[model samples]
Every structure is written in C-alpha cells, then in structure tokens.
Target: MNVLLLLLILSFASTIQCDIHTNRIEDTLSTEANDTNTLCKDHLQVPEKVRIDLYYESLCPYCKQFYVKELAPVVQKLMNYIELYTYPFGHAQMKKNDNKTTFECQHGPTECYGNGLHACAIQYLPKMSEYVPFNTCLMEKWSTDKDAEQCGQRLHLNAEPIRTCANSDEAINLVIYYAQETEKLKNMSYVPYTVINHKVMDPETDLIDSVCATFEKPPQECKK
Candidate 1:
C-alpha cells in the first residue's frame, strides 16, 4: 500500500513540475517586457556596437548549436551593444497544422511543434513584460520534448493560457509574420543567415569569429 501511494505521489509531482516549467517562461517573458532597465531596448541609443538581426530556422542544427552554446550567452553579455531578432524558416507551414495531436513529417509542416512555437513567443513582447524569460525557457527546453505545451509547463509558466494560446490562429500568424519579415530583412535563403549591422556574414566562419572577437576580445585579432 505504501509503495503504491508513493508511486502515485511521484506521478503527481512530475505532472505538476511539467506544468510549472511550461508556465514559467510566459511569466518571465511578461516581466522582461516591462523591465526596460535591461540592455535589449529596441532602436538602441548606443552607436559604437553593431546592430545584429539573425534570421534562422530552429530546426537548423547549426543555429541550435550556435544559439544554445554560443549566441544566447554572447547576447546576454553584450546585451547593451546588440539588438537581436529571430525568424524561423518554417513558420508559415507550421501554423496550418498546429492543432494536430501528432506531427506529420510526411505531408504537414515539420516545425509545427519546434521553431514555430518559438516564433509564437515573440508576440508577448512590449506588453506582457515576459518575453525574454519565456523565450529562454523555450530554448532551454528544446529537443527534450517536441511538444511546446509540455516544455512550457516545465518552465513554470502560467500553463493555463499558454495551452490555449498555443492552439490559436494568433500564435500561428505571429510566427508566419516573423518568418516573412525576416526574409525581407536579409534575403535569407539559408537556415542561419546572420546580418550584422547590414553586413551579411556566415555563422560557421565569419559570424562566429566576429561574435567571438567583438564580444570576448580575441587573443589574435584578424585584419578583416
């Protein structure tokens, strides 16, 4: 009897934990929007550092690796000097099939559950004051589970509304818009095309070096 009771308790705890994680991201994102004291102010006043807009697909491994391991941390450090934006390559298609209980990799959009959701996260900006935390939570939870709803709960978000928002046209359209605008910004035909202050650069070579040199003050400065 005790063992059965313990198992039930554990299952309940796990469910609760997932819900918390999912909602925490949204809550954090809301806070980020109002806390203007941070370095991510739009139309930045500073001039010395370059303005960067990154056009990327979440499915792209390079973008995932760069962002998870390198880019996000760099941005956090140089938040004052840089402006960042993200666009997913598969945003439009994802929305068309978002209500799906299971992903359709053969005919339907592939990123319906992946990068598509991240783009949806952008909608909370400037009003909810929780965009950053929500985004961070999403990124952190990436790959663990394909379902954003599950991930959102794990992030400690207000899971009730996020679940509703997850299935809405509003979320889908927002992601699509993010993709379309990103394509316009840099003519981005590739998954991880990076534009630094109007200068287009490659992530594997040029962008990586620039990000490192500018943010970390590399030991050997290239002439460029």
Candidate 2:
C-alpha cells in the first residue's frame, strides 16, 4: 500500500512539473512593445547564421515528439547560431467559398483551434524568444484548458487579444498561407517537416547534427 501511494504521488508531481511554466521567454525580453510600428518587431537577421524553418500542425503526435524530444534542446544549444522560423500549418486543406475559406485540419477542429492560437502568438508576440516559450506552453504535456490559460498568463499576455485574433477571419487566411508555404516545401511528407537553410531534411536523421553541419563557424555547443 505504501509503495502504491508513493508511485501515485510521484506521478502527480511529474504531471505538475510538466505542466508548469517558470521563467518564460517573455520574462527575459530586453525590449517590450510600446509603439505600433514595433508591435511585431523582428530580430535582426545575420547573413552568416543558419536558418531553420519549421512547419507543423497543432495536434500531430509525431510533431510533438520531434519538437519536445529533438528540436527543443537542439535549438537551445544552437540558439546563437541559428534563426528559427515556424509555421503552424500542416496536413490541412482549405476550401474557399463565397469569399471565405473553411479549413479541414488533419486532427480535426480542436487541432485547428490550437493552431490558430499558436499563429496568433507568432503574429502578435514581438520577439522570437517569446514565441518559443509560448509554443512550449501550447505543447504542454498535460494539455488542458487550464494549462493553456496558465501558460498564457505566465507569459504576461492578456488572453483576450490572443483569443480574438485566433478566432478572426484573418487568422484563418494566415493559416491557409502557411499551408501553401508547406506545400511548397520539397520532399514534404509529414508534419514537423524541417527546412534547414531552405532545404528539406530527412525526418529520421538527427537534426542537431544537421544544424551543426551548416554552421560557418560552429560554436562550442556543436563540439559536444
């Protein structure tokens, strides 16, 4: 009975840890939005840095696995050496009728809703750093409405603007645009499709190694 109780407690703790967000990227931003022109200010692009363009859907299991298991740590290690861009459009189809587009997501409506929120984050959030933590929140291990709300609040973002933009017609159009962008990817087959420096990569290979290989002057993290 004691052993069973201990296991239960451990599981509960693990769940809490997975769902919690502390020190989100927004908390560390040296800059904040105070001007309309800079509301979505992008980081300066260095010509010499490597680029990673990620295309994914909100509820793909494989995408989640690749993100949390592979891409997350690799990005951390290569943070200074790479530029990361993400599109939350995957195996989704859109049909236009009467000047409106209806979306058909691979994982259904809930996934579409999730994708909308993520897209809003990208569109609204000013810093690239902020997007990672926000997306990380969306990818919570114990995914729930409570978790989502907590994640947003943790990032010091008001929920109303994000929700409004997500449900708006504009967001749908942007998702469609992303879908078209994904379709343009060469050799595309699945969600979490990665394009490193504008080249589609095999999903089975180690993305970290691939990222390191592209560097003009590989950082110390690449040596490890």
Candidate 3:
C-alpha cells in the first residue's frame, strides 16, 4: 500500500514539473516572437533623402568637369538617398523685342543652344536615373544637337521627343524658369554653384564627404 502511495506522489510531481517546463518554453517563444517583430519594424523604416541643387550652364568648362567627373559617377550610387535639382541657366540674359524673345549667354550663341538642349533633356527625361547619364555624356563633349542625339542613342533612349522639345518654345520657357530660380540665390557670382539642403557647399570639399555629412543615417555606400 505505501509503495503505491509513493508512486502516485511521484507521478503527480512529474506531471506538475512537465506542465511548468512547457509553460516556460511557451513564454520564451512569445518573448522571442515579440523581439523579432520589433526588429522587423525598425528595419523597414525608410530614411529621409538628401536634397541637392546644382546651378550650372552647359558650356562652362568648370560646370562640365563637375557634372562629368564628380556628380555623374556618384549619382547612381546615391540615387536612392538624394533629390537632385539641376538649373542650366548661368549668366544668360533674356531680352524681349516686339513679342520676340532673345537670349545672350556668357559663352555666346552656341552656349545658349547647348543650354536649351540641357533644359529639354531635363523636361523630357524628368527622372534622374535617365537624365543624369544623358547630361554626363553631353557635358563630356561639345553639347551640340548631334552630341545630344548620340548620347540619347547610347543610353537606348528615343531622341526624337527630346529633339522636338529642344526646338520648341517649351524648351525656352524651361530655360527661362531656370534663370528665374538662379536669380533667387543671393549674390551668386559663379557657375556650378552647389547647394546641399539649402546651404551652399564649399567647392573645395570632397563631394561625397560633403553629401554624406548631411545624412542622419548614412548609407552603406557612404561607409565605403
């Protein structure tokens, strides 16, 4: 009789222990699931993009160098993190004579035409992914009509729309709009003027470093 009683006690204790162990395991799993959910939410949050404004003319050598050498290469890597605005009018004056408007560029008539091409590209492309490469190619050489068409072809883009736009009054209007935006900068006396988040960036500073400094959480490319 005593043996049977002891056996019963042992069985009861074992069942209680098993239940406690199972409860602990469930609690542990619940805690782990909550932690995973929290981590996922943090990981999925999007970061704010940096704003960059470039004021330059098509024919300026310094502007061309900056666009082709510095800006274009880094743009693709940082595209996700940047909002780029390009203004192609630099020291270009607009004069209206008896319902006809004429422009005189600092670099002369050829430059005015080149600036129109740039404005047209921006108007037609509208996306940095498309326009940046096209502009980079154009800036690397003389921005002639043939050069524009060639760049468009090299990028696998249809050049007809861009060509049509360049010859239209719409292109002139776009250039005029850029000229107005350029005029807003206080005491601006230079081409290739770069603004990062509304502040003028120093020309001597490394472009990447200057851009990375503005980010609250710099990207992986910035680390490299």
Best by lDDT: 3
Ranking by TM-score: 3, 2, 1
Question: What is the TM-score of each predicted model, taking all chains together?
Answer: 0.55, 0.72, 0.79
Write one digit per residue (lDDT tens) for candidate 3, span 1-224: 99999999997886665555444433343655434433433444434456788999899999999998889977978987787889998888888899877899989998998898889889889889999999899998888889988998899998778778888898888888888898899867887889997889999886788899998789998988
Per-candidate clash tally: 30, 0, 0
Q: By the lDDT metric, which is better: model 2 or model 3?
A: 3
Worst 10 residues of 3 by lDDT: 37-46
Best by TM-score: 3
Q: What's the distance in Å from true for residue 14, model 3?
A: 49
Q: Write down the worst ten-residue block by lDDT for model 2.
A: 33-42
The lDDT, on a scale of 0 to 1, for candidate 1 is 0.52
- Candidate 1 C-alpha error for residue 43, in Å: 18
The window of 10 residues in a row where model 1 has the poorest summed lDDT is: 37-46
Candidate 3 overall Cα lDDT vs. reference?
A: 0.82
Ranking 1 against 2 by lDDT, winner: 2
Would you list the C-alpha lDDT of every candidate in the order shown? 0.52, 0.71, 0.82
- In candidate 1, clashing pairs total 30
What's the residue-level lDDT of 222 in candidate 3? 94
Candidate 1: segments with Cα more than 4 A from true spot: 1-49, 90-110, 125-133, 136-156, 185-187, 206-208, 211-224
